[model samples]
Target: MTYPITRSYVAIAAPPLRSIPLHFSAACLTGALLTDIAYWRTAEMMWTNFSAWLLTFGLLLGALAAIAVLIDIFSGRLLLRGGLGWLYIIGNIAAFVVSLFNAFIHSRDAWASVVPTGLTLSIVAAVLIVINACLGWAIIRQRTGGLEE
Candidate 1:
């Protein structure tokens, strides 16, 4: 008599977007927002601390996330739930717009009180980004059937 052998397959829980991309997005945005805040508070030379580089890096990360999101959306790997995903995109857009305005104002005069206005907007955007990132991770975990993988 021959014995039957069975193989068991375990499913890995893959997120909508990998953790690295999401984490990169959060880190870059947080760094940009903090540097901007520091400049706003101290009226110091923002560029001395490489604020420009930080902002550029944050924007690059955001762009990468955007590309990944679009690809996932089109390929049906990520489903738009009209919640965190939309909020994430919106927050990024708002942050970009505010950052652009801040850059313009900063070019005019870094010490002006008006500089804070753009910085405030950026802060709000950063908060939204953070919230959206958390929500996104939760959603992905839920979709993948509980964070086992």
Candidate 2:
């Protein structure tokens, strides 16, 4: 008996647009992880110690997420990897909501309003969640009858 090997190429890619949301969510989670660590250690000075860096990190992360989302939508491939897609989708949605609350309520100040900032994050997160759900559905539909391979 003998076995044969096959070669294949996949040129079509899932759009990077949807990737934006995942990126932002990922960044936020990263920043939050850092902040949470600092908060636990420094208490009152956590914001003073790292707020600026975290804010910038979050902004950039959000921007990237938005770009990824757009790419995903344009290319029609939001559900990039099945299980991983769910991770990115749910994680991002939850991260976005928590980010809004943290930036707006937990980090509010007399002169430092976070409404615009948090709301902006929320929008990206929400958009990504919707896109992810759609993609998940489509991917599942594609795989329901047989193995994806």
Candidate 3:
């Protein structure tokens, strides 16, 4: 066996995953805000103007998500995991899928018909989901490293 003389090491940045709860919640809220703002601005263009229905559903979902996230955010614990986390994931995934459909199939037909209401708003949802996923994954991964609650 031979021994080496000099050793070189590369430094890798550790991600700021400790703040996943706050990051995820904040991103989700921001994403929703963006999508809603865009929707409100272009409400006149959509074929379906179910503003009341959309408002009710959005409030319900947003309240539940905000509550769940707030619990964890305030406590610095994974208060919402497993099913709750999955619920959030499912909602975001649904938004992403719907946006994909709107962006590609429904919205592409006409420049005016679908772009304003379909894919353009969907992109905001997609971004929110992406941010939430990254934050959630970081929190979960930190568990294996014996991070403090």
Candidate 4:
């Protein structure tokens, strides 16, 4: 008599719960970018104020996310392996730095605030945030073995 073969599969775990702040930070930064554009088009003070508030919230959330990442790293719940992980870190740092500078620029008068320089920085920060998010999701997928929620 022949016996049937059996196979077993292991389940992949979900990403760390602390990553929520990082996601929120990304959204706020993206929203700031949109508001910066709105201010540029309409020269409206309200949009400028909105961009400033968004950038502030993004910075605060990003700081919390950084702390959470450190905690995860120390607790062995998250791993940063190879160059991709470093790239993600560097990208996030760059995005945050750019946004910080843009926030300072936005503190100026309405018309001068989001013109050439402020708008340029917002664009750069938004682009960097997007790239970091892509890299982060790729890392998560790799860790999860392409598993879906």
Q: Which candidate wins on lDDT? A: 4
Give lDDT tens digits, candidate 3, residues 33-119: 454445546654342333223433443454455565566546655534556455555655565455444433332333343345644
TM-score of 2: 0.46
Model 1 regions more than 4 Å off: 1-3, 13-22, 47-49, 81-85
- Work out the TM-score per prediction: 0.72, 0.46, 0.36, 0.87
**Full ranking by TM-score:** 4, 1, 2, 3
Local accuracy by lDDT, each model: 0.62, 0.52, 0.48, 0.86
Per-residue lDDT, model 4, residue 89, is 81
Tens-digit per-residue lDDT, 42-149, candidate 4: 887999999999999999998998888888878866778888878988898898899899889989987788898888998999899888889988887877789644
Can you write out model 2's per-residue Cα lDDT over 7-89, one digit (the tens) per residue? Answer: 89876543345444555555554554455444545555544335445554675566567566556645765545557566655
Better of 1 and 2 by lDDT: 1
Candidate number that wins on lDDT, 1 or 4: 4
Per-residue lDDT tens digits for candidate 1, residues 94-119, read 76666556445444555552355646
Q: After superposing candidate 2 on the true structure, give the runs of residues whose Cα lies further than 4 Å from its correct spot.
A: 1-15, 18-21, 44-49, 79-91, 109-149
Q: Alpha carbon lDDT of residue 49, candidate 3?
A: 31
Error of 2 at 20 (Å): 6.5
Which stretch of 10 consecutive residues in model 1 shows the poorest summed lDDT?
105-114
Assess candidate 1 and give its lDDT.
0.62
* TM-score, structure 1 vs. true: 0.72
